[model samples]
Target: MIKKALAWLECGEIKRLDWYGHEGNPSQLLGDKQWPQRLLPLLITGKLQMRVPSIHTLGSYQNWLGYSGSNLAVQNPKLNISSIIKTKEPDFNELKFHLTGMAGDGNKGHIWLLRLMQELLNRENQTNKEITSNLRKVKLHFIGLEIDKSASLARELRYWGRAIMGENFDWTAHGNHQDTIRSMAKANIAVSCSKAETFSMASLEAMHLGNLLLRNRTGGWEEQLLDGINGFDLGETEQKPGKKEIELVHRLRNTLITPSKKLTAMSIAANKHSQIFQNIKYANWLLN
Candidate 1:
């Protein structure tokens, strides 16, 4: 079906072909022989125009083509800041760490949350602990929205999390947009474990709702998430929890036991950071 449409467009009287490329859906011309033979000639002849969300993706395509052309770096649509209602005070009796996205095969890297949970449990079991008494009283709950229910890896991870965390973890394989927003509202921190992302709408929404973002350093997340300010990056070089992750855990533990004033202040800072992605700014960029 895609081939037929491309063929028609190639032969038709169209002025130009505008295409959107990302990690998942790259240009067919950069792929196997079948489509490239049919599509590359047209693309090279100056008939094709492309738009990508990030410089990283644009560079990949440019390197593949061996030269730059009409590829434009138009970012993905930003979150609507107005729709998110900032909470003045969020209950921290049980520190809710929420992650929403696909889960399976480590594609979305949702399994990292499970790993972090295991690490926390291990620390709690240690004989000699330096953690404060108030920090020990703060419970942690992992809430996940698994967008892809059929993903085998995600399903397996969910089962493993339940087995380990028991009642401390909850996974909703099928959830609507509203359900995700509600989860964000109640969450103390929003976590993303994806190995890569063109742009993470889930993380952005979490920030808009004034939840501290705990995201991996990848994709457009770095653009909005400032370490130690709006959120903390889970390091880019390696996967395992290192100094940054340890510090983040410590901070979360401390935040849970801190007064509401400190939590509210953090929320306000996150909300301020999220303002750059407002719909008005996105509209102006698009228009220009």
Candidate 2:
């Protein structure tokens, strides 16, 4: 919309522009960057509007707004929430994990899958006595476009994981959104790894499901994940597999290692916190 807003506004086709985004301002929109309509007072004045899905983005993307002329950004960014009906998780004895929104490389789907599989391999080494209640026969499911053929290391790890863990540890890859939602309904935990984001929908959905989130705190995630409250805190996103990634899995592996007072409280808090977002009426939010 940024690219075409100038032309449309100049042509008098779009008098005012309202752009909505879930992520932070694009890199191109930062620094000494120009909004195409900036120079033309008649076309630019009160014409370029950015509507971020979360108000938290206002503070998070402050730098971007600085160089990009924040005068036009007077309106508050509103939170965009979906009405996902809270469903009851199915009765199951085994551990179930839902890796949140692996929408291809941007979300680093392959990295998350590999780290989880690596942790599962670690669990395979432990005997039934060594394994905790959370480690016995685990199941993880993710749905999205598959990683490209060039992701050799990730693919190799997955191969080894399935070969060693066999049916005892099922890591299912899916493509259907409906099925993924259903799978989430059955999961007890969620691991959503993203390079960057601002109040992501996937994270919101996971919280609404009463699933304990296990993601590296990124962007506005801090506003939702209260460290060991609703989710464990990792430093940041990583391009390579590292301790943080493994620690994420390790945390999940023994989330109930000794059963702390925070377990059910975390889920309850996550569900409760997400409900604030759910209450938002998008149209009314945008207008007001």
Worst 10 residues of 2 by lDDT: 70-79
Can you write out model 1's per-residue Cα lDDT over 173-244, one digit (the tens) per residue? 546677667766877778777777776777778877888778776666657678767767786725666656
Worst 10 residues of 1 by lDDT: 136-145
Across 172-265, the per-residue lDDT of candidate 2 in tens digits comes to 4544655566667777677766776666666667777887777665555656677777876656656655666665555555646625344567
Candidate 1, residue 13: how far the Cα is off, in Å: 1.7
lDDT of each: 0.64, 0.57
Question: Which residue pairs clash within candidate 1?
Answer: 104-154
After superposition of all CA atoms, the RMSD between model 1 and the true structure is: 4.1
Candidate 1: stretches off by over 4 Å: 1-12, 24-30, 33-47, 67-70, 81-88, 91-94, 127-130, 136-155, 237-239, 255-263, 280-288
